[model samples]
Target chain A: MQAYLTLVRRELGGYFNSLTGYVIIASVLLLLGFSFTDMLVKLNATPTYVPLTELFYSSYYFWLILLLTAPIITMRTFALEKFSGTYETLMTAPVGDLQVVLAKFTGTLLFYLLTWLPLLGCMVVVRYYTGEATLLEPRTTLTTYLGILLIGGLYMAFGCFASALTRSQIIAAMIGFALGLTLFLLSLRSYMPAPPTDWGAKVFAYIAVGDHMESFVRGIVDTRPVVFYLTVTGFFLFLTLKVVESRRWK
Target chain B: MIVRPIIEVKNLTKRYAGHTAVSNLTFEVGRGEVVGLLGPNGAGKSTTMRILACFLPATSGTARVAGYDVFAEADQVRRRIGYMPENNPLHLDMRVRDYLRFRARLKGLTRRRSRLRTEVVMERCGLKDVDRKIIGHLSKGYRQRVGLADALVHEPELIILDEPTIGLDPHQIRQVRQLIKDLARNHSVLISTHILSEVEMTCSRVLIMQQGRVLAADTTQNLQQIMSDGGQVIAEIAATTEDLRACWEQMAEVEHFNIAPAEGSYQRCALTPRGSFDLRPLVYEQARLRGWPLRELSRSLHSLEDIFVHVTRAQGDGEGEEGR
Candidate 1:
């Protein structure tokens, strides 16, 4: 337990101690700011019945930021340690492989969530300017953040798995970006013009992150997406643990 | 009562995909003993140390550390051994104090205990001044000290240091040697280096390896005695080279002799004895009986370097013949 906490603290400190953390935060806020203004302008031009949170989630910038930031945030988790030769030192300690992997996953997931705190701030700003308390509806906002957490958790685990495969951060990021893009594209199959009305479409809809978030912003709490994200996150984390252990034999 | 050895290995071997790194190697380090693994590069010293540290597993053989099997009870073994691997890898972004403290905690120390051990090791390693400096910015010597400090923070029973002084300057090497000697009072140290002088100075026993095999394992003194059974005698006498060679050839105790002309009429003769006996007194008497003026008469004992070279060279020849 102590080893796990110390590792987690060091992992998180790794981000805040360097300029990477601040740069990530600044870029996230800038992108969200653009999305917020665009949403407000569209609302003023032709008022829609959709809530502000739904409009924010529907922005192209939102998904782009989510996909890009995950790879960036987790690219250094295992890759930097290996490149610096610290992986041997870390693995030789009395800590278990599972502890190290889970700590990294949790640390990156927390930092990923931190970059999205601006989404709440943007909501507050929208509510203040529009003088509409409905824009800050408690249930809708909570579910939206939950969806963000689930998707962010899954993507961060994927990035960590990629990082564990190599010692170069650039390669790790490229692999992570490719994996995230593939998953996002797979989720888009349900939205095709001639979507297949078969079991294939059902599978696509089941894994579709877009449809999940749409229901979340509408204040619907479904168990399917929650289970799916948790299971996939667990699977990737398991693979990372095995990778760390396999280094010993090799 | 019998005291158990701190480390014991039985036929330990590690094979990579194409080649064997450590093959059928075996040695033991007793309690409170400082053993030096002396070998040239690629001798499998680091690989053996990694297996004992629980960082790597042996392909076939058994290793026990502090009464625990390395592979079966790795966690128990890890907690009892402090390992500073080759190149001394550390998190460069961390401060010295922070890194030591983190390592202490990772090694299973409580918060208060980790803080106390961190301070103790810092003081012992002379790292108090730069405890706040980032590791990457420090000089190589200071970084090496930080690595030593981290290894000591948890107070393990055995400390495995792989090539600890490889990159240090002369001054830093002296400091590190002194530190290792001081640590010998409380912990058993297993240090590996190719420098024979370092083993002579700091280690109680030496394990000389060649091509992933133990060439010789004994105390430095024993190795010297074993390699040079009767030792060698050097004498400078006021005589011709031919005359000195003739005189040495008549002595039954002398096995071989080399004589060369020195200054003026003096001749220098080096004599190897036939058995484990001191030839200095006999040489002195022979010179006095002949009424020859003798300038230098000394018995030269073999140094660890000669034994290391001799043993490794012998092994290399045996391997060459096998290959043929």
Candidate 2:
């Protein structure tokens, strides 16, 4: 357990020490701030009675930004180690393969969650302007943050898996972006004109990240998406561990 | 008291997709013994070392390091071995001190122990000056020291160094060699290097491997005796080629000889005698009888390179020729 925490701490320090990490944070903050202001301007321009939290969460760009940024946070997780040949040093340590994977997964997840803190500023600003201390509607906000974590965890795990597959950070980032885009695109089946006419529609609806967020925005906490996201996250992280171990043979 | 060897391997083999890197290798390093794994390129030295270090599972057979099976009890084995892999893999982004501390902690040291060991190892490896420097910005010598410090951060029982002095300047090489020799006083070290002189200077026993197998294993002095068993001599005579050839043809001990045209009116001759005997005096007597001015006559000491070439080429089936 201590070894795992030490690895996690090192990984977190790596994220903070590198320029790519700071760039990701800055870009996420910029995009979220811009989108928040745009949503506010549109909401105030029109007297429509849209809920403030709902208005903040409705932007399609929110998911797109996350899909793009997930790769940045995770591309270096294993790829840089492999590229620099530190993987050999890492594997020969007393720590287990599962521990290394878990540490990287958790560290990136924490950093991913931290990037969303700036969005809370939008929440605070909205509450202040509305002359209400609790404009976020507690239940809606909690469920929405939970949805963000689950979905983002899944995306970052896929990025970690991608990083494990190759020693090139660029390739890892590309694979992560492609994988996240695929998941996001799979969810977009809900908006399709014909929407699948069979069980496919149900599967897509069940797995659609946007639908899950929408439900959370309506203050509904479903256990199915929680199980789905957590399972996918665990599966990807398991694949990452396998990839790390199999590299020895290659 | 029965003392177990620090490392023991029996018929260990590692096979890649295209070829076997190490095959049917068996050896052991006793406690406090410094063993040098000497081999030419593509001779499975690193493969064997990696197996012993618990970096890769062998394809067949078994290896035990520090009383732990490499395959079954890898973590325990890892805890006992300090491995500096080929090319000295290290985190280039971290400071030297920070990297050592991180590695110490990762090796399961407590906070105080990690800090103390980091300082001790940094000083031992001559890295105190570069502790605050980022690894990537440091020179190759300093980085190599950092790699050494990293390997020693936890002070494991067995230290496995693969090409520990590779690519270092002569002074740095000497310093690292001295440090390794100093370490061998308290720790069992298995070093694999192309520099045979390092082995001669530091190793108590040298293992010469070729074609993924042990060609020879003995003390440096004993290996030199084996190398010199096929006697070799060199002579420089101020005589015509035919004259020297005729004189050489008279001696029964001279098996064959090669003469190269040297400076003005002189020729250099290399002769392989039939038995391990000092043939210089006989060659000088022949030169005197023939009235040939003997410019130089000396027995060529058998060097490690001759042994390496002889063993590697003698068993050459043309399979283990791939670059490692």
Candidate 3:
């Protein structure tokens, strides 16, 4: 347990001590600010009343920023350790593979969570500018935040697994971007016309990240999406542990 | 000096796809003994050290470190060993104190104990001045000291150092050498280095490896004695090569000799005397009898370099086929 925490602390320190962490945060904030302004402009012009919180999740810019942030936050988790040759120092220490993997995953996940905090800031700014007191509904707001957390957790774990697959950060980022984008886009099949079979529709619904967020934004806490995200997150973290362990052998 | 071996290996081998890195190696380092693994590059020194450090597994056989099996009880082996790997990899972003503290904690030290050991090791490695400096910003020598401090943070029983002084300046090298010597008083150290002088200065016993095999293992004095058993005689004769050869051939103890053209008419001849017999007097008599002017006469005892070259060359060619 102590070894796990030690690794977690060091990993967290690594993210903040370097330029990568600040750069990712700055980029995400800049993109979110741009997206919030665009959303506010549309809300002002629309005739029908739209929930302000809906704009936070419905904006294309928000999803794009999330996709971009996945690789940035996770690219260095394992790749930098391997590149700087610190992997040798890390593995030779009396820490298990699981502890190392979990620490790195959770550390990057914390930074991933921080990127979303600015979205809330955008929410407050939007509320103040529009003078809408009821814009901050706890039920809808909390579920959306939970939905983003689960999706980010899964994406960051994918990034973690990609980083462990190689020592090059560029390649890790590329792999993470490719895998994250593919998995995310695959979920869009749920919104398309009805499939030929019932199981096919179910599979599409099961994998659709957009459908999960839509359900969450509607204040529905279904077990299917939660189980799907958690299982996928756990599976990727497991794969990361295996990759790190296999490095010593090969 | 027959203390129980702190590290014991039997028929340990590591085979890659195309070639074997370590082949049927067996050796032991006793308690408080400093053993040097001397070999050229690609000679399996690093491979053997990695296997012992539990960073890599051997393809066959077993190794017991601190009385625990290397494969079965790797965590226990890791707990007892302070391994400074080749090139001494480190987290360049970390501060020295923080890095050492992290390493100490990872080595299973309590918070208070980790801090204490971190400070103690930093002082020991002459890193107190740069304890707060970022490792990446430090000079190479300082960074190397940080590596040492990191390894020593938990004060494990067995210390494995692979080329600890490879890139240090002479002054820094001497300081690290002195530190290793001091460390040997309490810990059983297994150091692998191509720098023969480092072994002579700091190690108690030397194991000469070549082509992934142990060619020789013995005390420094014993190795020197073994190499000197086949005595060599150096004589500078002021004569033609033919005349020098004739004079040397007359002596029954002189098996064979190499003659090189020296200044003017002088030829430098090196004679290998047969069966440990002193051939200086015999050569002197031949010179006196032939009236061949003798410029210099001396007996040459083999140094470690000479022994290393002779053994590695002789045994290397014989085992080349087996390695592939």
Candidate number achieving the greatest TM-score relative to the actual structure: 1
Name the lDDT value of residue B312 in candidate 1: 92
lDDT (0 to 1) per candidate? 0.91, 0.87, 0.87
Against the true structure, candidate 2 reaches a TM-score of: 0.91
Which scores better on TM-score, 1 or 2? 1
Encode model 3's per-residue lDDT on A77-183: one tens digit a residue. 88988888788778888888899999999888888888789888877777787777667667878988898889889999999999999999999999999999998
**Better lDDT candidate (1, 2):** 1
Cα deviation of B275, candidate 1, in Å = 4.6
User: In model 2, where do residues sit more than 4 Å from their true spots?
Assistant: A47-51, A192-197, A247-250, B234-271, B280-297, B317-324
Which candidate's DockQ is highest?
1
Which regions of candidate 1 deviate over 4 angstroms?
A: A194-197, B275-277
Per-model DockQ: 0.76, 0.61, 0.66
Q: DockQ of candidate 3?
A: 0.66
Per residue, candidate 1 scores C-alpha lDDT tens digits across A189-208 of 98965556788888988999
Summarize candidate 1's per-residue lDDT along B185-213 as a digit string, tens digits.
99999999999899999999999998789
